[model samples]
Target: MGIRGKDRQIDNIEFNVNDISRSKTFYGSIFGWSFVDYGPTYIEFSDGRMTGGFTTGEPVRTGGPLVILYADDLDCTQLRLKAAGATISREVFSFPGGHRFHFIYPDGYELAVWSAS
Candidate 1:
């Protein structure tokens, strides 16, 4: 189905880790989360309720983890974030399923907005 705007779905979350294998094993053993390995540096998981990913080989940001949200209109979402005084940390980039951009909240938390559009 095509995406529709303004819903503001909190679709998934992602974390940057120093070791994908270690994080996968730890979380899997503790929470029984299942994982899918995209490569040596990337692994996705489902915690039975929600889906998220662990990333390695990249600079993990300092403000804890990344929270990702879904938007139907990527451009409008970004504009709204900018208008709200959020800092654009990363410009829009395409991944396997969609495109996304990272922004920093006023309190210094980092988040991302993504869209299939």
Candidate 2:
């Protein structure tokens, strides 16, 4: 299966943490999430029905986890977000599985949109 059927849907949630192992241990013990390490800096987690990730690539944030959405066409989605008053916080960047960009919505919540490469 691919992301073709999940266009514009809430896809993954991500957290920036100081320690990936600690986060994995905590979530695994508390919520039974299973994790797959990508490298020293990142790990993917699955809680049965949903998937997310923890990364040490960024500083530990205080507000909340980043909510990510999937788009079949990243550029189109970005344009729509911009026209809806979102501020592009980060330009598109490639990760392991896809490319994504960050944005801040009107109320100051940061989110991301990704499309599979």
Candidate 3:
């Protein structure tokens, strides 16, 4: 079989954060994102073709909200994400069978990702 670019979905994204190290650990714990250390400037969490990164920079807390992704395990997810660098605008304790967290992009845009399982 031949390889094609379109065959793969968006696996990773890098959003600037106030502190790279903090965010890296936070997102990793929240979503169980595996972080690959990339020197002193950056780090990535990749699940095969799917990946995301955290870098040092100020994030935006404006604009439209972010797309939330549901998870099978939310309690741990929240704890992990919080450790990374996400400020829990809303804690994940009373949201049905799932929970979520929020973060700000460098563009002042607010977005959230969650899981319900």
Candidate 4:
């Protein structure tokens, strides 16, 4: 194989829920989403092509829903997020060859969609 620096890709996305059972039930009932439980507080679902995990409230809501977005350029992604009314919390910063931003939605909930640039 030829030598390469790296390739950017998304592993998965996560959504925070105050109630895991309720949320899981809702998704399963509505969209027929199947789930795998890591524990009582965690559950994962395959919502269409998107795969996301759910975490129940145990510690606290330090942030909000986390919707993952894969991109080659995190800076460009930041611009789109800002335009969409997401309040910037963490700016684009390179860390170990990746960049990410944490922002709050219009609902005053914080979430981050990270990308490796």
Q: Which of the numbered candidates is closest to the native, going by highest TM-score?
A: 2
Tens digits of lDDT, candidate 3, 30-110: 866677777665666675556665655335333321344444455665676668666666555454334456655444455
Worst 10 residues of 3 by lDDT: 1-10
Per-residue accuracy of model 4 over 3-104 as CA lDDT, tens digit each = 122223444667777888998889999999888887877888986776778886334455555655555556666787789988898776654336667787
TM-score of each: 0.89, 0.95, 0.39, 0.48
On lDDT, the leading prediction is 2
Which residues of candidate 1, in runs, are more than 4 Å off? 1-6
Q: Between candidates 1 and 2, which one is better according to TM-score? A: 2
The alpha-carbon RMSD values of the candidates against the true structure, listed in the order shown, are: 2.1, 1.5, 14.8, 6.8
When 2 and 3 are scored with lDDT, the better candidate is 2
Model 2 spans > 4 angstroms off: 1-4
RMSD of 2: 1.5
Model 1, residue 41: distance off in Å is 1.8
lDDT of 1 by residue, 4-114 (tens): 443588888889998888888899999899998898778889998888999975687776778899888889889999999999999999987889999989988888988
| Range of the 10 consecutive residues with the lowest summed lDDT in candidate 1 | 1-10
TM-score, model 4 to reference: 0.48
Give residue 111's error in model 1 in angstroms.
0.5
